[model samples]
Target: MSSNLGKIDVEVEVKSPVDKFWNGIRDSINLFPKASPNEYKSIEVVEGDGKSVGSVLLIKYTEGFPLVTFSKEKIESIDEANKTLVYSVIDGETLKYYKSFKGTLTVIPKGNGSLVKWCCEFERANDEIPEPQIIKEFAVKNFKNLDAYLIGA
Candidate 1:
């Protein structure tokens, strides 16, 4: 890692199967806003088909959500066989603090359930800025909430 780069890895256990969790994440542009309207207002594809690599999405957060109001994200990679997806922030309020921000999500089968791992890589715009702990916390909470929603669905 570079001197200016910061990384965060968080894992949450889910009652859903690995495939189910992976599918849900792949479809998050629709599911996230529907499942947690308080956190996400909407996610829409701005470029390409939302399913494949190179798709760009604009994500709007709810008014009172912390840190950022919206983000423009580009899908960098998708490995369905490995249940991994990688995306990078291209534009947003987050860009004011980060020179670059990328996230990888992977779902792994664990016994009867699954484990969702979220990894974030970011470069701060300046030394005075804090690490992206809020983003990590948001991801963990989102995973828990989405897991519960999936189980009930």
Candidate 2:
């Protein structure tokens, strides 16, 4: 199966400081399960020294889906100087539909708050499923959840 690759970018204005938003970005694995328990069951560090650049996160999903998907993301890069984070989905059910998936997050100072850009690049296994758009929507929703959780909004 062969199909063209796709990229999705979602940018949102967050009513939070860049430092605080960056902290939330770094703690996403632990915070996501707590904020969105319906979608995420748990996340555990399986490799490396935690959330650092080489670390791997094993994410378990909540029950009741026809296809239960587990996400294993490897932290590719973390640049605190630029407030940027990059991770790759090395394993999971998403790989069943995508040949590759890469997630990048950046926080830029905007006025008193911050502007967050969440981008995902994925190559589909075939043209059957629109995994790129699905992941994009998922990212946006999760970002909203994270923003709300961070600001207690």
Which stretches in model 2 have alpha-carbon errors above 4 Å? Answer: 1-3, 64-68
Q: Which has the greatest TM-score?
A: 1
lDDT for each candidate structure: 0.92, 0.83
Q: Write the per-residue lDDT of candidate 1 for residues 1-153, one digit (tens) a residue.
A: 567789999999999999998999999998898778899999999999887999999999999898799999999999999999999999999999999999999999999999999999999998888999889889998998889889999
* Clashing pairs for predicted structure model 2, backbone only: none
- Model 1, TM vs. native: 0.97
TM-score of candidate 2 to 2 decimals: 0.90
Question: In model 2, what is the error at residue 10, expressed in angstroms?
Answer: 0.8
Model 1 C-alpha lDDT versus the unseen true structure = 0.92
Clashes of each: 0, 0
Residue 46's C-alpha lDDT in candidate 1? 93
Q: Which stretches of candidate 1 lie over 4 Å from their true place?
A: none
